[model samples]
Target chain A: DQQVKQNSPSLSVQEGRISILNCDYTNSMFDYFLWYKKYPAEGPTFLISISSIKDKNEDGRFTVFLNKSAKHLSLHIVPSQPGDSAVYFCAAQLKYNFNKFYFGSGTKLNVKP
Target chain B: DVKVTQSSRYLVKRTGEKVFLECVQDMDHENMFWYRQDPGLGLRLIYFSYDVKMKEKGDIPEGYSVSREKKERFSLILESASTNQTSMYLCASSPGGGFNEKLFFGSGTQLSVL
Candidate 1:
């Protein structure tokens, strides 16, 4: 069973516009959520993360929001740049079991220049 | 900075042949992981190790096995190569098994089983 799901397989947005990627999860035991950005033929790099205690976390142009009640989270990039185009993956981790993580299928984001 | 390195960028093997994919980390991380990434399927964990000589099966460990003889290296083995095992393999490592620690990943090894 897929505990984490990214319903949208792809998204396209113009540069300097806001790009929103959504993810949903069915497991309430997950207490920490993270987003990673991956380019072609490269390993995924950590973007930003939010703890269950906090509803929102922001880092420069990247921001992550979590809604515990709905088991939903989103990664938003403001003024998206062409360099930001890549596959975005959302992952969840259990507080007690820190080593194991569950990842979503991923959403390919294309920022048009 | 933590660096996880996969021995090869690409590899090819024939059916019934034994294959080994090696991964090494510069940081003395206590936890190491092997994941397979496929188109549209995202990343699936094959195996993970918490410490030297210790390993745990992840969600899809059916055709794979792993070893961690040293603190800095982890190896994934395919006893008998099968076409279904063709995919991109990624290795990751994280500092102590602490809560909220992020993972550092290798570039990945694209393996093809013919």
Candidate 2:
């Protein structure tokens, strides 16, 4: 069973627009959510994260929103740039597992300039 | 910046060959992991080590084995390489096995089994 799921396989957005990537988890025990970005032949890099205690966390142009009630989290990239065009993965971890991440299928975001 | 290094960026192995992928961390982290990423399937965990000389199987441990000889190094071994084993392998390390701890990842190794 997939604990974390990213239903959208791909998304296209115009530059300078808002790009939102969504992720859902089934296990209620998962209290930490993270986002990672990956390019071709490269390993994933940390983007942003949100704890279950808070509803939202923002860093520069990136914001992560966690809705504990729905077991859902979303990553918002404002004023999206061409450089942001890549595969984005939503990962989750239970309170017990720590940095052990459970990843989703990932969403390929294409920003049209 | 914490650096996680994988021994190779690319590797080629023949069927039935024993292949070893090595990962090392310089941050004195207590946790290390190995994952394989495939197209459309995302990243799947192969194994993880929480301490020196201790290892645990992750979601997908079949046909694979892991070793943590030292605190900074984690190794993944493929007993027999197959075409299905061709994928990008990633290694990561964290200071502790906490949910909020950030993982430092290596550049990844692309292993091709023919």
Specify the highest-DockQ model's number: 1
- Residue A63 shift from truth in candidate 2, angstroms: 0.6
Residue B16 of model 2 has an lDDT of 93
Superposed by TM-score, candidate 1 places the C-alpha of residue B62 at a distance from the truth, in angstroms, of 0.6
Q: What is the TM-score of chain A alone in each candidate?
A: 0.99, 0.97
Best by TM-score: 1
Encode model 2's per-residue lDDT on B1-94: one tens digit a residue: 8889999999999999999999999989999999999877888989988889888889999999999989999999999999999999999988
Worst 10 residues of 2 chain B by lDDT: B96-105
Measured against the true structure, the TM-scores of the candidates, in listed sequence, are 0.99, 0.97
Query: On residues A1-113, what C-alpha lDDT tens digit does candidate 1 reach at each position?
Result: 88999999999999999999999999999999999999988889999999999999999999999999999999999989999999999999987899999999999999999
The CA lDDT at B86 in model 2 is 95
Which pairs clash inside model 1?
none
What's the distance in Å from true for residue A72, model 1? 0.3
